[model samples]
Target chain A: MNITQLPFIKEIYGFLGHDLVAAVIGILIILVFVPLNSAFLVWVERKVAGHIQLRPGPMEVGPHGILQTLIDAVKLMSKEMITPKLADKFLFWLAPIVIIIPAIVCFVVIPFSPLMQVREMNVGILLIFSFSSLTVLSILMAGWASNNKYALIGAVRAVAQNVAYEIPLLLSTMSIIIMTNSFKMSEITAAQSPVWFIVYQPVAAIIFFISTTAETNRAPFDLVEAESELVSGFHTEYTGMRFALFFLAEYTNMFIAASMGAVLFFGGWHGPFFPGLIWFVVKVYALIFVIIWVRWTFPRLRFDQLMNFAWKVMIPVALLNLMITAIVLKAL
Target chain B: MIAITDIISPVLVARGAFWLMVTITLTGALLAVVPRNIVHNILGLALAMFGITGIYLYLGSQFVAMMQLLIYVGAICMTYIFAIMLSPPLELELPKRRKAKVITAFFVSLVTFIVMAQMILSYKWAPVTSLSRDWSIETIGQQLLTRYFLVFELISLLLAIAIIGAIMIAGLVRRKN
Candidate 1:
């Protein structure tokens, strides 16, 4: 069903027109969902981390620390916003907003179900990748504006890792694109109604997953915010909500990356009995859970080792997989 | 009091957004030129690229617009910043200008501006009565492979050679050390 056909939406569309109504509704969903979804993910991550370490995390806020992230967000909001005397005032303030808008804007193209999604652009996957790249710029601004050496180092490391991993990420994704012959997220999903891409292209799926983990700065690739080493990395100088914005954007990015993985490999919104939206959510969360599990399971790789792994191992493997898929398809 | 809806109607809002993007592009261009700080210049260029992407969207090529964002805003600008930020600041200050040189530069820029403005004013913008052009990604991909295959491969070869040259230069420096 067309969203404009809905009674309330139709009323709004009459008053505001289709484009305005769509923009307003999208912004509303982003504003409402970003915070709540991020908070929930924070709670989940902490809980998962705790369980992995054989402990219960944050039990005091509510039963099993259910309200912990909410309280934590309040605490962060209430704290002082500090600007270092040496900092570049304009870009320093711009960093968090820059990081966030793109993170949330990515949801515009994400197909939660056949009926859902803010807008279905033709180049859905490219749009997401484009916005994710903007996040790198925000990190650069954050690191540079702060005028801290460690922050700069962390930012530089993060950029290098992201840029390196992005190659393999695109390569793996290209293989899927080759198979589907389309870039629209829903179309890609629909193409897999018969059999999931994971069954056909397992190698691409694994490479894609690993590349996404590094892309999101999740452990053991969490060198961007490595607490023990770089004192929270590029966000070392950020305080209160400013720091929390980065935290929130990180989880949202994880969600976006995981959702892409789900759509590409797991036959998005495709499953037995349950509706499309539920299956989609289940797949997204399942991918996210494995990521979090991997985070706690492994130790962080060394800087050189990380670069080597991306360039030497991941790229060649992903490229070989792409070529093999292409030849196979052409042969068929 | 006058009604607010008259001033802020949906039609006006869409036009206002396009104008906003135009203003952003101009501001970013000015920032890029005026700023003495290299980092600020990079940021401005990045911002301008975003504005240009918006303009591309309005011009009816979503594929090109997204590519502008992906290649320029995302990858290229970030690389430019990384190149500078990771190194010590360069001595980028302009030297004391000679009067003749200043006059020459002024005339060059003025002539360039006049030529561009004249071309823009002379050209006619047709009303978009039909969406005839298929600006799809697949069409573009096919065109590149079939029509522009040699040109694409040449560019790729050039980039590969440049990369090798850069590596050789760096290795030479290390050997000298």
Candidate 2:
């Protein structure tokens, strides 16, 4: 029987019938997947970095250091939680929770498969953009609550970076939405069955990818949390679980952004041979690998340079791409 | 006198729940920006924005709701925190509200809200009867490229200019320092 047809599903169905049940299940899924995904990504990133640096990566700790992240997580959890004496105790505790809430919620509208999406909507693309922007605010909160000079500087850098990049990210996405018309992820994928948008709007695709990376605070664009410059950036004062929450949120966000790029430009869940869902995951992981590669390979852009690239380079390219796509589609 | 079927009505409960969420969101938003303590304001904003996301879910825009949380709560709020952190003035004691400023701002906001609300309520929203019922991502694409092509191009041009301007301004600021 199809999962949608299950009687148990009805128990948790309706607008308000068992929203609590739905929420609980949703949180459960996030909790299970986030840590597992973070572990896998951490291992993958290290291995990738190791190979690039010409050094042997982790060999011990459960099969080529696959268990390293788990060990680290345990160590982190066991450590004492610290709060600066000068900090506002209440807001300090609240900041991390605020960050994680959006990261988890973002997964809701993402179409993992046709049947796998938690909540499908007409405006899926807009939803993702809006929700992702909230991270800036949360980071700012974390920085302020820390009451540390480094944290403050990092938070300021983060705000400037996010605000700068957001324009290009939105513009590039607008090109896709113009080509597709609907903001729904599933619909965008369906439109690409005959031809993926990336084929026609390659420039937009590149802009989207770059802007998304910056948006997620990944390497090269990760000035907010740059260790060498800002001393761990905004979350410098955080310890134990609070810091873990920030880390988990960041990795999960990266996964979500990469997966979204797959859905938008790569014809989500569509491919010949193998199920649609399989194709979707393959594309997503491939993109994720590329992101990791970029992170390790490139030197970080200066904060000013980063802003300039987004506003001057990406935005214009994305706009021109959209215009060209629109005209071509119209003429055809 | 009670009807047996009345207890099971989903519509009533759904409507009630939606209004509750709306109240939570609006209240939270008010708290987020108005509070003297920057931290409290952020919390309030988060709560409010989360509520707005809930409202979006009800409006058949799950995607927008998710985006609202992700972008506003995750990113913008974080930015605000960073701003507070960076600003020395933020560390100062909360100032007492000036009665005149408070009254003027309140009246202006109230008037604006009422006017907008009235206009929205008065407008007639006509559904497109001839168009396909499918507002799926696929159809949106077809329409955007085929029917709304001009508008699409215009938006792109506008975005290009905005980007160039933002870069120039930021670059100038950095160079001066």
Candidate 3:
């Protein structure tokens, strides 16, 4: 039977028969997947960082400290939530929720494999970028609501950094979209099956990778949460689950950026001797590993240097790459 | 989870969502003008922009909706927040409450709203005969570069000028300071 032809549950308690059913199941799956994936990534990152520094990471909680993050999660949940006395109460609470929602919503449009996406949005790439940009607003809110000078400075730096990096990120991505002629994630991935964009557009790939790192506030660009400088930056006053939520959003955003990088430049979900889902996961994790490697390997750039790199170097290069892609596409 | 679809049909669901978006937009508009705090006002503007994005989605333009979210909520709202933060604190500048001015402003706004509503209600709106259903990004791009080429170039020029002027003004202010 055609699923679209299924009868609507006319009764209040009637079963969800078709599209709604699929949507509900998708939401449930995502709800389970986001937190689990983020938790695992946290564990992996710690292990990777430790090994990079020639040390063994957490080994007490679970095998090779695999369950350490879960234990930390529990501890964070039980901690007390503190609101600064002079903070704007409404915005202080709203910021964390805002940050988390976009992080999860963008996941719906991310195509893991041909059959594995919550919603194959028509403009999936744009949707993800747009929603991801909301992270800046939340950081600003968190900083301002904390009523701390350090937090405010951190938030300002974050906003400036994000705005500066987003241009090159979008421009580089635009080159791929021009090549693929579609904003849908699945199409971008499918076009990459023969030869991934990284071959033709090496410069864009590099620009995209660098900008994604900055966009996610990963290492070198993580001046927003520079512990040594700003006393934990924007979330200086947040404690308990509130702070945990911010952390979860950050990690999940990193995952999204990596996945996007995989889909855009690398041949996503395409490999020999493995199922498409496995291939997709492998590519994403590989990108994530590189990001982690870069995070721990490189020293953070100064604020002025970061800004100059984006505006002076990345943007102009991306624009030139985009123009070349357009001319080549037209000539072909 | 139980399916409440029997009680709420698809049409009902869509209508509910539409009304919710409208309510959000209206509330945000109210908050934007009514809020005493500059931060609240900026947030309200962002909320309204979000609501408008939903409306654009319903109008079958996902690309425009995303652009709306990106440019207005992401870039413009952040700029406003940064400006507000850099400026003097609200507490330092006490606003003088004038009952007569408030009343006059309210009266003017009310008259404008009524006139606009009346005009909209009386007008016999007709759907365009040659409505193109091509809401794709490609079509939009082609149209902007082809049919709307001059307008597009003009808009870009305007934006470039505005940005340069802003920077020049800021530089002058910094020198004076």
Candidate 4:
């Protein structure tokens, strides 16, 4: 949406060129939205996990730990951004920034509401998916650059895991895109007015949920950063703000993945009584809450089992689902 | 805020950006060839592909740009990285004869470039008068199925064969282990 639609913004746009005005506003939105949303999601995850385990989370911080993540953010910012002396200096420095860029860029095309989006590209879903895949490259860089065996192993596992799960993820999403016949996020949402896609494409929805959890490195699929096994995985040597950027990007990715799920299967922004933005947020959070809950509930999967499941089961199932979807679409 | 048009027109900005992309593409290509490190070479190739994606975007082919990013940077580069990381590290030392080989490679590439440039310059390119302006995903799908059906099927068959070949090679290694 054009910020210049507002009278005050229109005045500013008259002084600045429209391109500059839009560019500035888009940057500002990402700057504010990414960190703020990440902080909020972190708080929500902690609170939900705490309650799930029958304890109050961050009670000492402001009421119900609302201010806890803010305090943590402050602490993280003050800590040292240490670089390992023997590490590849260029790649070590580049990895965290590279990881975060894709996470932030994906937000630009996300249709938050009918009126709220940075840019509504025709290939929005494709753009997000393509950029998100770049995250594995950063992870690999981070791991390899650390000059640590554990970090390298973690990176290898991450690349393997992401590469395997991505097939199922794309296949399932292709099912929905086939039905909707467009890659645009807004069109996908609009097409779901009659019924949420979860009803018709339950298998795809299930596969999507599973792969997304793996995609974001959450819980069961989080072998990339399995603390007990790999000593904090790919970001083992990263500290302070560098670590915080990875942490923030992880949460932001979780948010984006869930938002995509909501948009694809949960009838994004389509609900009674409430406005579209509110409904959209509600659906997204509901998915995020489920993700967090699942994280706290399940044990991490074995590395070999993860690969086996992706290849032997999920890929075939997702492919079958796609074929059926195409046949049905053709018949209709 | 100074108006961008006051210093340089929009067309000038676009032209400048186009040239910048071309420079990036060439530099990346040079890096891919000149780097001794295999990883650096892979990353340089990725950079070149990304610059080409930018060129595609400027040419009003957003779909193709996204696909290029998806297939080349996301899939192909990652595959190269995986193979690099998985395989044993190579010895850095090269044979003396490699210098002559490198010169021959450079000469061949230069000759090819000149031939391609001459061909491009001599050709009187004309836009197809009946070309459909629709660049949407739907139209692309229709064209692929109707106009390019056999070629599309052939490409899919080729991909399937490649995948099977990869699986067989990987299986051989596993069997050896």
Candidate 5:
């Protein structure tokens, strides 16, 4: 049976398929943006790390080391992808793609400019949060499939770390959600026209930023990949292109976390004497810079310290912040 | 269950992408049961949940769809997989009585499917008004607090009572020790 020829199904698709082209175009833009943004961020992270330690980073690669990432990408792609003899081939291959997929899909809801959102849903924030959690599963799969002790240990840490941090992450965001009375990225941004949510929910903002940084597995939350202990954690067995895919996803996730924080706390794309997209980009990069700075300035927390901080410190503070926000909103 | 069928049957009738989601869901269930490996079974359950998230999207509420993903796939599935990773999988086989039970189960499900299909085929579906139906999060929130206020509060009260009872039991155990 030719299903597409079915009259009823055809009618329904006909009714709602008008946006198909536009949606494809939007996805294409995101596809192009993900890699470029990741590469640029990696270059910036290196440059930032270099200057912090008093050295010129990647200056030999190109003028000001701008083309360093491009060369690195080429080097990564050309390298042989080695699969461990004992590795579960199915899960090992699936992990990288699975990790990357949701990170790309998350771009659909993010508003780059007023007119530049891919697909705006009432539950855009939830969509991102939910998929972000899926990355934890991917990390576990990669670690377990590698059949390596270090990899499994790394993956285990990732799951525990993500599960603990996700509470404060959601709680902090809930405070902002209450203030705006909406979860749509556009609405969350628009609600901040008069004053940024950071002004009203500063505590929530701090927790949100910290939790998001942890969510992306950036330092001082990079215990998932704590080089000293786990030897690159869950990705110890990956090689070449497969490793690059994980890197690509990691950097892209860092941007998503930063941009989402911008949308929540900073007035996204809202600034004087500049376009919305420019303001949005500027805010994102600025946050990324701070994240990188924190990475260098701070040391990674131990496993117990990370868990206690999330449960005892971050969760309680975030809950208190939420209660206060709700009470104030009610009284006002 | 009957009311759910009434809601889903109309969307099910539009069988283009709907069928794709259905196939995915069936495949996921099959993977969950047919796999000898426990990890594969867990992942199959996750895949089925993912397919359900798509179906929820098709049913016109992105909120419900994301919540399905967030709660079921994200939290519950993660917990299951994590525990599975920690514990060893069982490999004991059942006795020959399983054949009879499988046959009976198949017949029961087949009869149920027939009855449900008959009901669906007999019913007249109303035209979808997705475009004209303009509802917001605010409206849903208001309805929950006003119309379903008792149910909402009662559920919260139930959770609170459960938590306190658990704590009370723990306190008694500690005191005895």
Candidate 6:
């Protein structure tokens, strides 16, 4: 539709108008995509898990269980809402909302295609991280509000694991920011024409991927929701749609993390063939597949082991990667 | 139908959206700290931080925004949750609000927000006249190595020390068990 040629562009260029219409349109796009994408991710995860276990997944639902997620979602919608007797009702109800808000908001700065960004701000990467942290807060709120011992333990483990991994995540990102100079995703993509940053800073990319997996609470880092031990983790007491929100946030976060990996390590939306958006989706889904693969392949790490890995191994490697990148860039 | 021209300018609309985001952030911050329930407070903090991330995007720092989501949403909030989980006593009673302390903190935060807002409103932010428009990742890399080499090196050293310290403290805690 030649969005660049839209009248909104001229107004933005003139610096005399507000792109309210465009902004609303952008927000609507995110609202639609998030729920839809999350639903699909659920189906994908189940199918992947089923295949790994050699079991038929969602065979009863439409066409090889394609409609299973939708049916489950509807069932959840109809189920009774339950609040624990000792729980703080207000915060308990509020937790899921908080978790979902950041998931939706972080997409504001994510550039889907060259012309399809909501807000092509200078600090897109930072915005995503800042908002994404709220999910953790929501997780904490969920655990606290549940008033369950297991939920509390799960929340504690989740937080510690998150904190331990965060340093390396930020450091690896810094290495990229140092390499790119610009915090803007658009600029970072543009900088990688002949060679992607993955080639220049392979170590940072590896650290980034690992840290992000931990960051998103995916396995082997899914200690928070470790089914065998913590039961259901932070959202243990949650039921119905409230429980679904947390589920939605997790999958959404997974998608966002994968998209970030695509944007950072792979040449986000950059390829020789097909459209930019297609390339972007391909890279993102490819990364998502790897995440699922890792999830099914590895046994969950103990909470202590998870924390130690981040503090001891990933952080040092990330720092060293940054240092080497700096030296190489200098020597050149 | 109303003409598209009747609506506010896109830039002004953007500003309005920005103000809306700011309001959401500030209000969320207030809610986060003032709520009697610690959990409510944390949610409020998350909302407020999300708002801040929006502001960062407005300020042209996407990397920082993503980092905000990754670290704060992914890490810090998780830590707060961990604290919540570990401290069982916190669930026994609602955290009592000290009126005097609340009043004082409110005044202080209000004053700070006002002063900061005033300063921002007052300042004439001049664009860097001769700076390259190329805000590419390569430029950041080049600058980090050539111009900001000391800072880069220091950051690495700082990260190294942080790792050692975190491990030592965590290990000590584990050993005490």
lDDT of 5 by residue, A109-218 (tens): 99998999978877889989999888988998899889899998888888888888899999999999988778899999998898998898889989998898889999
Residue range B15-60, candidate 4, lDDT tens digits: 6667888998888898888867676687788889889988887665
**Candidate maximizing TM-score:** 3
Q: Candidate 3: where are CA atoms >4 Å away?
A: A1-17, B1-7, B95-119, B127-132
Tens digit per residue, CA lDDT, model 4, A213-277: 99999998989999998999999999999999999999999999999999999998888888898
CAPRI rating of model 5: acceptable
Predicted structure 2: lDDT: 0.79
Per-prediction RMSD in angstroms? 4.9, 6.7, 4.2, 4.8, 6.3, 6.4
The list of candidate 1 runs beyond 4 A from truth reads A1-16, A19-23, B1-18, B90-128
What is the TM-score (0 to 1) of chain A in model 1? 0.94
Candidate 1, lDDT over the whole model: 0.87
The TM-score obtained by model 5 is 0.85
lDDT of 1 by residue, A148-190 (tens): 8889889888889888999999999999999988889989999
Q: What lDDT tens digits, residue by residue, belong to model 2 across residues A60-91? A: 89988889999999999998999999987877
DockQ of 3: 0.40
Instruction: List iRMS (one decimal) for every candidate.
Output: 9.5, 10.8, 8.8, 10.5, 10.0, 9.4
Lowest summed lDDT over 10 consecutive residues: which window, candidate 2 chain A?
A1-10
* TM-score, cand. 3: 0.92
TM-score of candidate 6 versus the correct structure, residues matched by position? 0.75
Candidate 6 or 4, higher lDDT? 4
| Candidate 6 local lDDT, residue A26 | 91
Q: What is the TM-score of chain A in candidate 2?
A: 0.92
Candidate achieving higher DockQ, 2 or 6 = 6
The C-alpha lDDT values of all candidates are: 0.87, 0.79, 0.87, 0.87, 0.86, 0.80
Task: Tell me the tens digit of each residue's lDDT in model 2 across B77-97.
Answer: 665665555456664676778
* TM-score of model 2 (CA atoms): 0.78
TM values, all candidates: 0.90, 0.78, 0.92, 0.91, 0.85, 0.75
What range of 10 consecutive residues in model 5 chain A has the weakest lDDT sum? A1-10
